[model samples]
Target: MRRDLASNIADVPAIAPAVQSAAADGAAIDTKGFSSLAFLVNTGAIVGSGDFGVKLQESDSSGSGFTDVAADQVDTTAPATLTATSSYKLGYRGNKRFVRLALAKTGGTSIALGAIAVLGHPDHAPVA
Candidate 1:
């Protein structure tokens, strides 16, 4: 049997919890030593009605050119109706070296949320 322990993974902040009323880009996670990544989203308050989606972007450079990852590449799609005080996630399996998550919003008040990037399957063990 095999198991993936904490030592095998690296956790990075994708975004911090805030009252977000506008579109924002999350942290650009570098996947040099790791081979896999996942974005975990925590949402709070539903003051806004249609802030239910986040786009996964990737690029060769960490600073720019982060366009949305293809729909088929992501493991999960954020629900159409986002619930208050709930959690969501999206997995990354593309070949890009850098990746990030961008919150998508339209004509709304504010939604409190944040995210974290979990990187796993390191090229070498112990993910230091």
Candidate 2:
């Protein structure tokens, strides 16, 4: 009888599929998931000459609405140049969820944009 009971239990199907379906229906995957999200400012509409600075705001405006994750200083000299390359790694805790890149200019002059790329595991893995 015990042997038969053990075999029956082993044959039982798991309910994992139901749980996974629930997770998919409720929670939305962010960059922490297999895919990542990013934005670029090339038109120079956000920043221009004599601009104090530029703030990269998260498009999602909710509880933690757009926060100033990063900023860049503009160099105000002849042939104004971007003081530094503005790049920021955004994530919660120790995990790097997303990467943001922007340019800062002192004067109204267009600058060549730096190539931005994203790389990571094909599967959803926590940023180490």
Candidate 3:
């Protein structure tokens, strides 16, 4: 059922602090009860010789085990490269209990970037 936008304001789901990419790859995120998620990524500090890639990942287990979710990612034509400051959005709806963003960088020491994910549960009913 479609809900009125105003009524859902208080229940709006959001990820805590925006996720920032580190110098190296990080671990998976836990999404036990959320049925949906939207990730927003902002990139910066890219040099001509640096490259970066971000992919949406999911896993049934809550641990480090994770695999890429087919077809759900940013940069459709070419893998994400930090040629300039840019913003990208990606969404996921799956049966897995855990989800996360995977970051990969090459030819550079770092790529300045941050991401935030908003999660939703269809069964979440708002209080009157």
TM-score of each: 0.91, 0.28, 0.66
- Candidate closer to the true structure by lDDT (higher is better), 1 or 2: 1
TM-score of 2: 0.28
Which sequence of candidate numbers ranks them by TM-score, best first?
1, 3, 2
Model 1: residue 6 alpha-carbon error in angstroms: 0.9
Give candidate 2's root-mean-square deviation (CA, Å). Answer: 18.4
After superposition on all CA atoms, what RMSD does each candidate show versus the true structure?
2.0, 18.4, 4.6
lDDT, residue 97, model 2 = 43
**lDDT score for candidate 3 against the true structure:** 0.57
lDDT of each structure? Answer: 0.85, 0.27, 0.57
Once superposed on the true structure, which residue ranges of model 1 sit more than 4 Å away at CA?
1-4, 48-50
Stretches off by above 4 angstroms in model 3 are 1-27, 72-79, 125-128
Which sequence of candidate numbers ranks them by lDDT, best first? 1, 3, 2
lDDT for each residue of candidate 1 in 1-128, tens digit (9 for 90 to 100) = 12557879999999998878888899999999998999999999868474656889999999888899998889975786556798888999899999999888765677889999999888888766
Stronger candidate by TM-score (1 vs 3): 1
Over 17-84, each residue of candidate 2 has an lDDT whose tens digit, in order, gives: 11010111111113434333332222222223332122233324223333334323211121223323
